[model samples]
Target: MNGTSDVPDRPRRQCPGCMRTLVVDEQNFHKDSLCADGFTRRCSDCRNEAERIRYSLEAPQRARAKRERRAERRAYFESIGRYEAA
Candidate 1:
């Protein structure tokens, strides 16, 4: 023996989000963020979809937050008598 372990390789995994059979390899899986496993649970396509949906749902809130921040900055400048009316 060349000193390699005799354990069999793991079988392919099914993506929980898409139900697609996938080979968990460097080319397919991403580094897991939750630290439960070494690879991500969902496939790339599923991950992208999830991100897209999340952004779409939160877009309005994000835009509103940005506008509020800008308004607050303008108010602060005005209070300091440095803001010019436009």
Candidate 2:
């Protein structure tokens, strides 16, 4: 026997971010239209971790930018005499 019977019929996938092999299935991957396999290259966990880290690093900057935009809008409204005290 070639011993290939031990493996499952479904293809196995490797996550690029973590380089861990896992069976290809909906639970293990996020569907993506761009990929040939119709799934993301990195597993959901890796992608989520990356997004979490990025959000943590940029949250302060994003908050500051949002505040600046609000200030700009308020100034514009005040200059146009449309400001209402809130």
Candidate 3:
């Protein structure tokens, strides 16, 4: 993932779960994690853990975020209304 030639290369690591060797380059800004397929993917175990956590929190978290964004937009529009009237 390190497109820049200056970086030497990513060090390879063996995945404990899959038993596959994969190269992970910390210098690459684009990839969060590298899999054995040389594709960007979270480790299997980590992905499963994240999914479990996400399922538990997704509903309320999403609702609160949406509500906050809507409130922000309403406030911004209200603030601009007086200027537009003049």
Please tell me which predicted candidate would have the highest TM-score against the true structure. Answer: 2
> Higher lDDT: candidate 1 or 2?
2
Q: For candidate 2, list the clashing residue pairs, or say none.
A: none
* lDDT, residue 74, model 3: 76
RMSD versus native structure for model 1: 3.5
Off by over 4 Å in 3: 1-33, 39-53, 82-86
- In candidate 1 the C-alpha lDDT for residue 25 amounts to 70
Candidate 2 residue-wise lDDT, 1-86, digit = tens: 97668765888889988999987778888889898989888888998899999999999999999999999999999999999998
User: Which parts of model 2 are misplaced by more than 4 Å?
Assistant: 1-8
Best by lDDT: 2
lDDT of 1 by residue, 1-86 (tens): 89888997765789898899888875667778575667888888888888999999999999999999999999999999999998
Worst 10 residues of 1 by lDDT: 26-35
Task: Count clashing residue pairs per candidate.
Answer: 0, 0, 0
Clashing residue pairs in candidate 1 (N, C-alpha, C atoms within 3 angstroms): none
Q: What is the model-wide C-alpha lDDT for candidate 1?
A: 0.85
